[model samples]
Target: MKIAGFDIGGANTDLAIIDFDQGGDIENIKTDFRYLPMWMKNEELGGYLLDLIGEEIDQLDAVGVSMTAELVDAYETKKDGVLDIVKKVEDTFDIPVAYVGLSGMMNASQAISDPLQVAAANWIATSQIASIMSQNCILVDVGSTTTDIIPIKNGLECARGRSDFERLGTGELAYTGTLRTNVAAIVDKVPFDEGWFRVSSELFAISADVHHVLGNITTEEYSCDTPDSAGKEKEDSLRRISRVLCGDLDLLSTSDIESIGDYIYAQQSLKISEAISEVAEREFLDEVITTGLGRNILAARAVEMAGLDFTGMDEFLTPEECVVAPAVGTAIMMEDYLSDE
Candidate 1:
């Protein structure tokens, strides 16, 4: 059976097309993501999904979905966001559509009945994948806009918070991310010119700029939109990062730019590490299984700072595959849902 799984996040929508053999083994998989800010383009979702899955729609057996876009301010309430997204998905696809919820995969009716359960449960799908490798570990998923610190014990998720709001209180969610997070939110001060420089709390740049200037991500890997809507060039990122210190490339030396970017990168890693420590101390787990676009750089550094045994999902999945792991897990869960049905 062939299934298409979607992880519809607020900033990007990821898709995984998995072809499964008769015995339930995955035969092939193709994954991709599109930058679609839900706050601005929420209504264009249905068409985008169809376009993303173009040419293969006729051969698809079913569709599966996991989303975090409900938390976007585009909707007045999470319920309203869920219902609207669900309607778009329902209207777009002709085959069976399953929503990955906090409990398990559910049909549209079940999803409609309880929207909050499906609000931010994409991490649950990733945990399902993590549990396959380690029954006891924290799954640290650092995506474009947020990080999820999930604990799994005995092959089941033991997350304390069911909602994003509650997860923040439980230290299972960190608002910092790789490409889209505001630089001001990560650190207010940076090192430059042998002196500590306080940064402007404006959205002058994003984490992508820091990573790009530091060579953590290439121009192509800076997948999301830039803070200043500038070109995704090394020099452009250098300029953006310079602005965080209330300067420009003309004023800041190359070494100064590197120092500021490196400092911000370290502080961002600390932010995620602090959350990992909190979840680890609470769940009593010493090992971490990592995935997402930031898995290698941000997640890996944070795991090291947390002082835990770390394992990258790259052991079982390629680095590219790790980018949309929740989507891959959503496909697996949907296959399981089909068998159960």
Candidate 2:
């Protein structure tokens, strides 16, 4: 059988393809992944994505779709977005399209019967994937705009008491990231030549500037959106951070820029630490498994703040590959569901 899985996230959409016959090992799998900006804004995003797959759609025996879009809005808005995509896929391919449940980690067989209930339970793609990667631990995924903290025990997701709405207050669901966060959110004051000066809340620094200075993400990843990240130069990163100080790049030296970046990390770290503590207390799990682009840095600061040890996903998987670990894990879950039937 030819199978394909797609994970539509807030920042990017990832697609993975696999081939397998009945009672045979699935090999020769190929994956095609891409990063798109403002993906949720494209009304025809469903059709736009199908066009990318082209002929591959015809060869697929089954296709699966999963997303965290429900977290984006209210019930009707989310339902419309998901169903629209599902209808478009079915209309184009004439194949079965199963929407992964958003509330809990379950197979299509189980999810198909009651996706609403599943999604309502916070059935996210990460938990499904985390179940396969770790035994008993907290899964921390820091995405473009937010971070998710999920606790797993004995292959099942533990009810952490706090819902998505609650976590949002603790920095798990904010419009901040390692590459895109506004500088104003990190600090209220900036040091000038002599003493200190207040910063305008209107001005913000890109999370890229912060991560670059902190040595978390390299220039390669920072090259996309920052004002001067195109050249992949340290000077550009410095300039990006300095821009937050009202385009006064020369006002602050490179060392000062680095200091501001460190300050931002420290600020964000405090917020992350609070979120981690809430999750630990709610689930009674002390350990946190970190993943995603800023997982390493966020986890490090969170550990120090919470007095907990941090386990890096990189210890088991490469950073680039780890970003899509949930997609891979969801596909693995799909394979298991298909085999059981």
Candidate 3:
């Protein structure tokens, strides 16, 4: 069976195409993601979906979807956004389509009936991999815009919070992520030049800039728009990061800028670490399974910082596959749903 799964978020839409043997074992998997700012082009989603599918459109047996794009500012309410996105998927293909909801996979009719059931539920699809990977662990997926930390035990997702709102209170959701998070959201002050320099709340730079300067991700991997709309080169990142201190290159030396990047990186890791600690302690889970774009750079580092056992999803799937694990999981899940039917 061939299945395509899409994880649509506010910033990026990730696609996973999986081919399964008759025995239901994955034969091969291909994944890719595009930066589609839904706020500006929510109407063009159908085109983006078709572009991702490309030639595979003729071969796909089914398409599964999980989305967080409903929470984007493109719509006045989550319900409205959900309806619009669902319509696009429904209109885009004649093949079988299902939406990944909080309760496993929902048919297109069910999704349209209760849109909130599927709104911002991409994390749940990603968490399904835990039962196959480990018996007791927390699944931490750090994407470009947000991090999903879900607890699973004895082959079941045992998250205390079902919604993003509830997850935030349970420490299962941390708003900061690898690329798009504002640097100011991570820290208010940085220690430099023998004094603590407070950062500007202005959108001078994003986590991508700091990660670029720190060499965590490549310039090409900085898929989100740069804060200053400048080049994604290291120097451009350095200059933008300097603005976090309310200054430019002329005011901050290279060493000073590197220091700021280091601090921001540490704090970002610490944020995830603290959340991991809280969730791990509350759930009695001692190991972490990290995946997604920031899985290695941020999630693994945060796992170490939280003083827990760490397992990168790359161990089971290639790093490329792990980067889009949610979509992969959603595809596998849809395949299962269809087979059962």
Give the best candidate by lDDT: 1
Q: Residues 1-341, candidate 1, lDDT per residue (tens digit)?
A: 99999999998999999999988899999988888899999999998998889899998999999999998989999999999999999999989999999999999999999998899899989999999989999999999889999999999999999989999999999999988889999987776666778889989999998899888888898988888888999999888988888889889988888877888899999999999999999889999999999998899999999888899999988888899999999999999999889
| lDDT by residue (tens digit), candidate 2, 1-341 | 77776766555666667677676456645555555442445355566567656678778776666665444443355555445444555565666555556443454455545545334232355666566567777777776556677778887776433445654654344345566677777677776667766666663456777787767878776633554435546676677677777655668887787887777788787777777787777667777777776777676666569887667776765666466655555555566656666
In terms of TM-score, how similar is model 2 to the real structure? 0.79
Return the clash pairs for model 1, or none: none
Between candidates 1 and 3, the lDDT winner: 1
Q: For residues 1-341, write the lDDT of model 3, one tens digit per residue.
A: 89999999898999999999998899999999889999998999999999999998999999999999998888999999999999999999999999999988999889989999999988888888866889889999998888999999988888888889899999999999999999999999999988998989999999999888988999899999987777999989989988888898999988899888898899999999999999999998898899989998899899999999988888888998888888999998999999899
Q: Please give the lDDT score for candidate 1.
A: 0.92
lDDT of 2: 0.62
Query: Where in model 1 is the C-alpha error above 4 Å?
Result: none
lDDT for residue 273 in candidate 1, whole number 0-100: 98
TM-score, structure 3 vs. true = 0.99
